[model samples]
Target: MGTFKFSMKMLIRDYKKSLFYGLTLVFAVAVSFVFFNIINNNQLADQSIAVGGGTWQNVQTPFSSILSFLIICFCCFMIFFANNFFMTRKTTELAVMGMSGSGYINSTMYVLYQTFVLLALATPLGLLLGRLVIPCSNAYMYERLHISKDVNIIPQEAYIYSFLLVAIVLAMICVLTAGYLHRNDILVLLSQEKEMNFHGSSNKYKPLLYVAIYVFGIVMMFMNPHSPNAYIAPTLVGVIGVVGMIRYVLPDVIKHLKKGVFLTKRYRLISISNLSYSIQRSLLLFTLMTVSVTGMMAILAANQQNPREFVTSVIGYIVVVLLLVVSIVYKLIMEAVTRKTLFFNLWKIGYTRKELKKIVKQEVIMYYAILILIPLVYILFIAGRFIYYGDMTISFAVIFTSAYVIPVILSGFLTYFEYRNAVVKPIQGGK
Candidate 1:
């Protein structure tokens, strides 16, 4: 009881961290519920066909299985990263506990307690939200398609499956927490965030591996083996390329920028240098942006290629909205966690708050440029196709504008807000 109370207090005190955890779980549950509903719908369609009914033949699979796989992958990745970030934030406290002679078992217990508390709260809310939203979504789809089938709001097996998946995720988090604690002692854990260092010697051959993977993915896409597999192969390859671009390509680009006369100006130098130093973290943000953009492109392509597929189009739009939200939330949280201290030190060393803001703004602009470039190029290609087909309608224009403008506006707002809170507010507070 005492230990549970302590865990609850800790969670309450760091409510922001817990909030992200809960949100991730909510996302997971919602996605899982939707997926199960999809499977159930597919089963019903199959049954209708088996009963000598041709009326349902025109009802193409609304939700692609590949989309389900992507959702699962995204949920798992978010959960792992969120949990790790929470643990990273608690490094100092954990070190203190360790120094005071807290046993490993106690630390593990604390983690389990926190996990249980979050799961207990988030699971029901997620399930309830999923229950409410998914039915409406299905009903909307049916209305759009002019289908007479009744919407299934509650699927018994789906609810059970979602709960089981959530449980498995909780178990994985507990195991990971235990392993991380067991591997690192107090001193190492305490110093974990002190510096960002890249110890690997440059290997000229690594770029070749990335290039090969990218090529392979392109080839696989052209081959077009199957539905889900086709999506997976190319996407997985693109992810590797994005990560590589961040890890290898971006740093090199920054180094070249530093050599240029333009960026060498003193005002710009700090931002460029900060970007170079924190390249790994910068890469992570960029990677998220890249993946989101790529996912959006994929979804839009599906909608464009299958004009009659209203369900696919709707899913595409939904995915784009979700990606934008995820990107904004992720960037804000990560920037707060990783860059706050560095910005603080810059302030202490004679840099003004305005200067810090400029640097941040510059960094963000660069990221936005890179993130938006690919998607914009693709959108242009799509526009070109519309022009060629003499189908450049107002609807397309509206969609293109919304898809392009909204992410840019939202990203800019998030960047400004993060810089204000993480860097500016602290400076103001110190005064």
Candidate 2:
């Protein structure tokens, strides 16, 4: 009991250090919840309109079902990751506890205590944040078009349940992570090093190969975007391309950026290294951003005077962009913070500016490529398909999505590059 209480107190005392991570998890989960909400509302709206009755209850039930489904997944992932972080942080402490005559049960209990402390702190905040999203989203949609909505604001009771569920999942993750500590030897715990051994191929031509694969995927996706059938093959291609780039292409990209090759253009080598280490993380981040921007562009592409255009076409674009932007920004900000922590660690390892610059360049290029590819492929395959099978009116939407890809890619790359420089320079110089 004493050890458990002490662990909780220590967590609270060190809360500032953990706060950013907690908030980031909360934010990601919150965004996931919101996206789920959007999807729920849309499905509900379609059902109600189709059946021609049942007021908002039809929408409400579906909304709750989908929201609950999404929240469960989000909570699990967030809690598991948080538990892993806690275990890593407390490895030495747990080792000491075990050595000091504490049984495995005691250490596990201590871990549970810490997990509950975090859950208690995070839950209410997450619920409040989730509830606040409703009015803001409603206003944005309303402002996008003056269309009145039958949308219900997120109820207070919903927030309470959300908090409870999130808390329970986090607690369970804590128990799991703590159990791992008990199962490991004391020596193993004490000697553990926090090394990230991400696997990848060492081939020199990997980046270009991945770039080609991604291009091919995009072309495939765009080849027949309008047919639901067309999207399947392209979607599979996209998933493969993204995975290939992350696992194989990214590491080689960093290498080429550091040691320039004849095939690489003048600034291309530098750019690759600048952005590639966090390639997978950055790719996911940019995909979210691209989706968001695409949605916004879609809205602008539509004719506003027509009610149907405003509801279907414009709203569709808005939703895509909103989903993308929300997902991307949430990822980028969290990643940006983590990247700073990484730089601080790198500085401890005696890394130089040249080395850091190379890493940043690799990351930037990988991210830009990934972000650009999604929109381009979607416009090509999906747009063409829509023209052939869905609707000719969507042609303009495709054109705008195509036109908008370059700026979005460039802007995302530049912003992260600058952010990386700002966060790293001070730590590098001990400023």
Best by lDDT: 1
lDDT of 1 at 278: 49
TM-score of 1: 0.80
Q: Give a tens-digit lDDT track for model 2, residues 1-431.
A: 68977687767777743564476556645654554454444422434353576555544443234433543454455446545655656667778888998888788877777766666666666656756775666556545545466445654444554555565676677667666875788888776533333454667676677677767866765455343344556555555565666667757656654565624453454345334544554554444344334333323333344332343333344334433443443344334554566666666776666665555555555565666665565555555555565454565755566545645565566556665665566573543
RMSD of 2: 6.9
CA shift of 376, model 1, Å: 4.5
How much is the lDDT of residue 196 in candidate 1?
Answer: 55
- TM-scores for all candidates: the values are 0.80, 0.61
Pairs in clash, predicted candidate 1: none
Candidate 1's clash total is: 0
Model 1: CA > 4 A from native: 42-63, 149-152, 198-239, 276-279, 282-313, 316-328, 374-405, 428-431
